[model samples]
Target: MADVKSKASVLLVGGGSVGAIAALNLETGKQAAVTIVCRSNFNAVSQNGYNIKSCDHGKINNWKPTKVLNAIPKASEGSTFDYIVCVTKNVPDVPPSLSDLIRPAVVPGKTVIVLIQNGLNIEKPLIAAYPQNIVLSGVSLIGANEPSPGHIDQDFPDTLFIGAFANPNLSPQTQKAAAEDFVSRYSAGGKTQCSLDTRVDWTRWRKLVYNSCLNSICAITDLDTGRIRLADDAVAHLVRPAMLEIVAAAKAAGHELPATVVDDMIEMDPLDMYLPPSMLSDTRKGNFIEYENILGEPLREGEKLGVPMPTLRVLYYLCQAIQWKNKELRGLVSIPPKGNYVT
Candidate 1:
């Protein structure tokens, strides 16, 4: 049986930008007991704590978790949390996948696996691992970066879209319960948490529309979003075409991604031109990029569905080359960066 406590227990597994921002927001009203797994940066985080500068959740100079661990701690041996958020990057090639990271804190069939990372069709592995566990996801539009240890910069849209995974085997009531529980803990401030389209699956596909363009374009060319499009007619010849391929692929896979997304992304101001994307930043900094989960999986899906994504295929191959170079340069096999999107 589940303990019906008013206060929830949340175990955040990554101390990256999204992880810090999530910790700051979810712990409002101290509604939930938040424990952060800092991994390698545990020493820095334990002493300094999180230094957050946000456009939404205004400057929290020192936001410390109830507990921090260098790895999945034994403290979770007999304990289970209401929410287990994996803000860590979803690199399937990596060992101890997300499924393994949440093991210690999980209560078997009861805990909710909240994946706050980027990627499409990412919830499948968790859904397969914990068939009964309610899996929820969030697409964070906010721009967040880790400039240094225990420090995070959260700039941009003060909103995040979250809801239950699109799965027929799951019960809507159960999913909503999990969503509402998170909302209850997350709605302390003016932060916007939207549940659009009555289904959360579309949100992931929608973000891909922009990410596929900007993330790849910026990473390959080593330029910001605006600069990439502004150079050598890149927007017309490269970015726009790749985005169109994604739109077509999504449609063929039975997901409707609006065609207007291309124009909307192109026209984004400030706002749009500056700040390189997470993937782009990671590549430039020689950090491990989420090539497989973010780009590879989506392209494979398009191929499986018979959707011809020649542009996306090319983009994937390019990103993969960079990924290989980074790995070879660093002598690494499988491990996400300490901060998921930290560059």
Candidate 2:
């Protein structure tokens, strides 16, 4: 890591609720100049800035970024960012790749790319795309949502576990410094705390304990995580079984995730009963959900390792069906009424 600078030039992509929280974290007394690239609310955010309300940080209205754009600028064609934190959905092979979007901002040894996304093997493409740049993976445990344009509601105690993506070439000490430095910059007194977790693979697989079950299950059953777990027979018949299958797959993949992972997920406070997971939110909005990375990849890996994930396979197929329907709607494909439909 470059001599731990006081001020880091950060480029944050994906201006969703997670992105907004991250931007707020970087901006509140941190010495980083945060620039956001918003895909949907570019005009609103550009004209009026971002407005956020958080249980941790309180109300911060019209908090503007250094710059906002729909895409990376042409002028930044050769510029460099000290850090590029992406708080976007992990839908690889869907939109642009990370390197493609942030090509100009990364300065090999100087830049660190932080991916705060869900699921296993999310960093593979970014690592493959920019083999020289440092890549970090993070999993955030919190409920946040963008209810309206430029308005975000953040739940309390956002704990982000960050770790360096395993690179044989990079020494452990170097990875530690980079990861800890980010923790230092992002961890406010108590708002959205960040920690350096050395176990990247463990974090990813363990988080799947909640994600593989809560995210898809919630979306599938039209219930929140709590509701799904609290229902009379939901946990026994569906949630626990699916999570056990995931744990088996993780073990087969050489990461021994404890069954307590499932327990912890099941025990998550039922107070936030209506908070929808991103997958469910996307489904509700008729937007594409991340099926491959979150579900398919692990299933494929399990199959390769001779472990069958029939439950995950079925749920994955369900999510894929949702994805297909969403893709068609998002692509502006119109379906006529049953009487007028062309056979």
Candidate 3:
């Protein structure tokens, strides 16, 4: 494997909050030749650059990358990338389709794609699109949001865990080395830590359990993390049952995720942490909620695996209905007679 530091090209799809933060961090560390592709027009980002404000790091203004493309356009005809980082939401009903943009960058044995979104089911579509490309899954505990175009606000700086998909033929040493290099590069000027865990699937499932319990519920109730943390009754009454369903779904999917993961999740007090979830921010801004990828996917998979996930099913449907209702009230879109939970 080539040294990550020696690499000259990197493509970052989805210039949302997380993507912008990652790009700024990567640029600060001088990691590879970085290019950020955004759905918004180039003139907008080019004029103002990116403003990244973090609780840990003071506001950064005009943090620009090597290149910013409005969209992924055939990879510049012959351009290739060493690493492709995808930080887009996987809500199927959302605009700016991420999978279609990323498909052009997945060349096997040449490009490695790292998914840093808040979902558990991005792998299926990614693999179907580029089976031979080295696909890695990861979970970020960091809290981030976009206050405006070309601006990202990171509330909580947290750890990142990354590893290749389960495969007997994967080279562990190569994966570890790559992960370490990525961490070192991104964390050079920051305090974040990235670890290489072979148990990538378990880690992802653990995060899924967390998201399943927190994101949508907070969005639906319009509660902040601090409120949820202080409310133990809410955890036991609502969160725990949903977590149980998520655990059952993970187990049925052949991943043995421990129940203690949920306990650890609830142990995070939002007041002490002083961070809000992206779902809450999305709801406040009237953006689409990523209900399907986090909650709906698990519920669907659970049914297929013969696992009972009633709590998750109900929560998923409720979130969809709520989002649909919001859209209808706002006159954003006409709600379909049969509500679809794709987003």
Candidate 4:
């Protein structure tokens, strides 16, 4: 084992499914001392620890990290974190942005901000917030979730692709080193897959092909990926066309995706598998969905480049309406009384 004193101090800011499983692997690496900031799960995790059944790490019971905190400020107190891994959802339209939430713990040049969330253009806000800091763009392809507080289940193996977001303020060497360092620590245990990609935007756009098309479809229709494919003419008429639009947009944005990527993504899951996507899960729970990053941003980008995305445009508005309805249902938004007819 590496010397305890030499372990990098990591403050993980999300304790959801992805966050919880990530904490497990980070702790397992032995290269970082992970302190997970649990918001909703704080009580359960702090009191009972986590019970995880994983295909990657095997079944581990009552697993707790080196440290756990209820809030981000508490983790920041008297501690200078070397890395702040943000595994939270990137709901840009929501209040208390991720940059704002994690600002207190950021040590500027020292603390590397690693974002493991979804959607497009996620790095821009962080880059603007901490211009001097090295921001690593991470794309996680793992299937993990906490069904309940302190209870985790991961059927898919972890495959993480990490790369540094270009910052004019910091040298490429500095950014590259930070990305490499974090990838090394994350993969030190040899139980997970992490790779450094110089063209991470390519990967992001690649993921967009799936998230923008299928994830959105799943959310709006309340169908798992498999059922969506099983639906009458859904793949040929809706799913494939939407994915193709994303590919066209990605190409316009200068990241040419493989021609076969759309089909590969479609065939990734069996037709009968009842796997509800993250967006669908959020919709079921009456939580906000990430329409802005996943759809709005990409749609706007496509529009800017004169790439017509009718299917994606329709999906974006539908998802936005879902978000509005969810907010209204939760009483977070109150609609005004119907206006007097002026006609």
Kindly report which residue pairs in candidate 4 clash with one another: none
lDDT of 4 at 286: 81
Off by over 4 Å in 3: 1-4, 40-44, 55-57, 95-97, 167-190, 229-233, 254-259, 272-275, 323-343
What C-alpha lDDT do the candidate models reach, one value each?
Answer: 0.77, 0.78, 0.73, 0.88
Which residue pairs show collisions in model 2?
A: none
Global local distance difference test of model 1 = 0.77
TM-score of each: 0.89, 0.90, 0.83, 0.95
Off by over 4 Å in 2: 1-5, 74-78, 188-190, 230-232, 269-272, 332-343
Residue-by-residue lDDT tens digits, candidate 4, 1-343:
2334368889999888888888877888889889999988899999989989999998888888999898786335687788999998889877889989998888776789999989888889998999999999999899887889899999888999999989889999999988888888888888999889899889999998889999999999999998998899988988999999999999999999998999988977666767888899889888799889999999999989999999999999999888888778878699988988986
lDDT of 3: 0.73
Q: Which candidate, 1 or 3, would have the higher lDDT against the true structure?
A: 1
**In what order do the candidates fall by TM-score, top score first?**
4, 2, 1, 3
Clashing pairs in 1: 269-272
By lDDT, the candidates rank as 4, 2, 1, 3
Comparing 1 and 2 on lDDT, the stronger one = 2
Q: Could you tell me which residue pairs clash in candidate 3? A: none
lDDT of 1 by residue, 1-343 (tens): 1224466888888988888778877766467778898865677789988888888777888679788877765435665677888888777765668887777777767888888888887888888878888888878777788888888888775467778885567788888778776766766544645343355667777788777766877888898876776688888888888888878778887888776888887665364548788788887777777777777877888889898888888889998888877766767656656776656
TM match of model 1 to true structure: 0.89
